[model samples]
Target: MANIPAFKLNDGNEIPSFGFGVFQIPADGTTYKAVSDALKLGYRHIDTAAAYFNEQEVGKAINDSGIPRDQIWVTSKMWLQDYAYEDAKKAIDTSLNKLGLDYMDLYLLHQPYGKVDEAWRALEEAQKAGKIRSIGVSNMSPKLWKKWAPSFNVTPAVNQVEFNPYFQQQELRDVLADSHVALEAWAPLGEGNQDLFNEPVLKSLAEKYGKDVGQIILRYEHQLGVIVFPKSVHEARIKSNAEIFDFELTSDEMDALRKLDKGKGMHDPDAPGVADTLLNAFDIHAND
Candidate 1:
């Protein structure tokens, strides 16, 4: 196994450059098996959430994998319904109980809406209580981040967003850069969008590096200092996604890939004429 690089967060904690994501992993034995397999394959970082409803399975995998709790980095999130101060705290307890862990490496506000300010306060309390090591947000726009960043004594350590070559968030990235906040890519492979896999430049680069187009994209983001959580149920891809540390992309190649950014989200939060659907999409029911 190769040594994956680590990024130092503003809070002084180090995060693995790559992690395994359990976004839609069913809360069954399959989830447990997949996560355990990832750990055995040298993945120390695992990203999950209360809304995912599979934290228990993730916990079971870690406990059964024979890895020390401190040797692994576990991250989970607070859903919208649990955004109030009291609810958020309870949610953390529920998550910890579900995962059977003493603490979380990082905990994030799952979205920008609902009672986020109150939820953020809960995150602060959790940090103070040692329930979570670092605090951050997910899917928060730069506007929201600016308004919220000043309110906390502890600055955000990270911002998880949908980042891929086609949807490179340069503006948000710049804002986070100024605050020393690290960025994490959720849909790093564009949610398995086939069009991205067929891009000419990616194909060319894949051939040059003797890697798949997905590998090329992952490497590009890695060079840009964005932590990526590429989800895969397949074992081969699980290993391939982590094999990116051995090579580097040149400046010209990086620029060519950057050109693929269309400046709009492939998975837009505000899709036109779908307000109800969009709102529902981020609702708690979607997770259930």
Candidate 2:
């Protein structure tokens, strides 16, 4: 377990730049074992969500691993089904109880859907009560930020979005920076998009640095100041994902990777039917 570097949150707490993402991990006992393996390999940050349906398993791994709670940064999210102010508050408590933690390092609204501002209000109150250290949103875009900005008293500490070489979110990044909101990238390895691994620029840099294309992309994003947490089911890939800290990518190499951006990635966060989809997805199990 080596010392991993951290980035300061607007709230004054520091978050490990690299974390273990459990987006698609099954909740059927696999998450517990896999996350325990990651913690054993020195990963102190674990990202999960109620939507992932693995918070209980993730919490089990963290607690069972014998790591001090303060040393581990745990982040979770509230599902759209729990977006009402009162429901959000209850959901927060439910997540805390499930994780078996007194406080969360970061808690996000899983999507920018349904009573978002109201949901945020619940998060703020929780933070004030010491139940949550930091609060933010996921799948947020600059357009959505504008509509939701006026109501915020405590600006979000982070905006986790779909960011990668193939879909570099430079414009939204700048807006978030102005508000001191750190940009966190999800699906950073292109969300299993093989084209990302096949990019010629990434391939070249990988060969030059004696690393894989994923490592090159992760290093490049870190250099760009974007917090990245890539996910994998294999122990080898989990260990390999954390190895980006050992190398440095030249500015020119970074620029070369930057050129690979085609502004393509996941769904638009501000799509017209988000609320409708949110309402319809009440029975959907995200990581079942």
Candidate 3:
């Protein structure tokens, strides 16, 4: 397994340059085992969300790994119903209790819903109180961040989004540049998008470099300064994903991958039905 690098956050904290994501990990023992495998394979950063409902299992896996708490960086997000200030505050404690951690390395607002300002307020307060090391947003685009971020006392340290060769997020990066916020790529492998890894450009580069197409794309993102936490349950894949750091993607190769961008992927936070579906399915509330 290759060692992963850590990047500096706007808050003066360090974040792993690469990580393992537990988006759809089952709540059963599967999560514990996979997380344990990732840790043993040298993945120090693990990203999970409250909506995933596997916090307890992730916690157990970390505890069982015998890795010191300071060595592993854990991140979880606040979901829809937990957006209000009071709920967001409580949700921090809830996630902490579930994860069996003294404090999270990072926490995020899971979606763009009403009461987001209040949610941000809660995160800001928590950082001050030493509950979370850094705070950020997930699924928030530049357009959305511009509208509401003016009210934030502490600027968002990161914006985790669906990023891959397919959706390079050039426009999003332009805005985040002004705020100095990091862009963390979720589903960094396009979640196995055939068009992504199967592109002739990626194939040619992978062959040229004697690496997999996934490694080529991850290297691309790494050079572009986007944070990526690709999820995998297989031990082989988990081990292979960390190998990108050893090689460098040439500028020409990076440009070729950039041209492969289609700017489309699953889950658009700005889409019309997103809010309604979340509100109905999750019993979202704007109040504490």
CA RMSD of each candidate after superposition: 2.2, 1.9, 2.3
lDDT of 2 by residue, 1-288 (tens): 457889998888899988999998998888998899899999988999998888999998998988899999999999888888998899999999899889999999888877998899999999999999999988888888888865888899998999999889988988887888898999888886887888888888889889998888899999898899888889999999888887899878888888988976777877788768767876634433
lDDT (0-100) at residue 263 of candidate 2? 79
> Residue by residue across 126-207, what tens digits does model 1's lDDT show?
8999999999998866777776678777788999999999899999999998889999999999987899999999999999
TM-score of each: 0.94, 0.96, 0.96
Local distance difference test scores for all models = 0.87, 0.88, 0.88
Q: Which RMSD does model 2 reach against the true structure?
A: 1.9
Provide the clash count, candidate 3.
0
- Give stretches of model 3 more than 4 Å off: 283-288
Error of 2 at 193 (Å): 1.5
Worst 10 residues of 2 by lDDT: 279-288
Deviation (Å) of 24 in candidate 2: 1.3
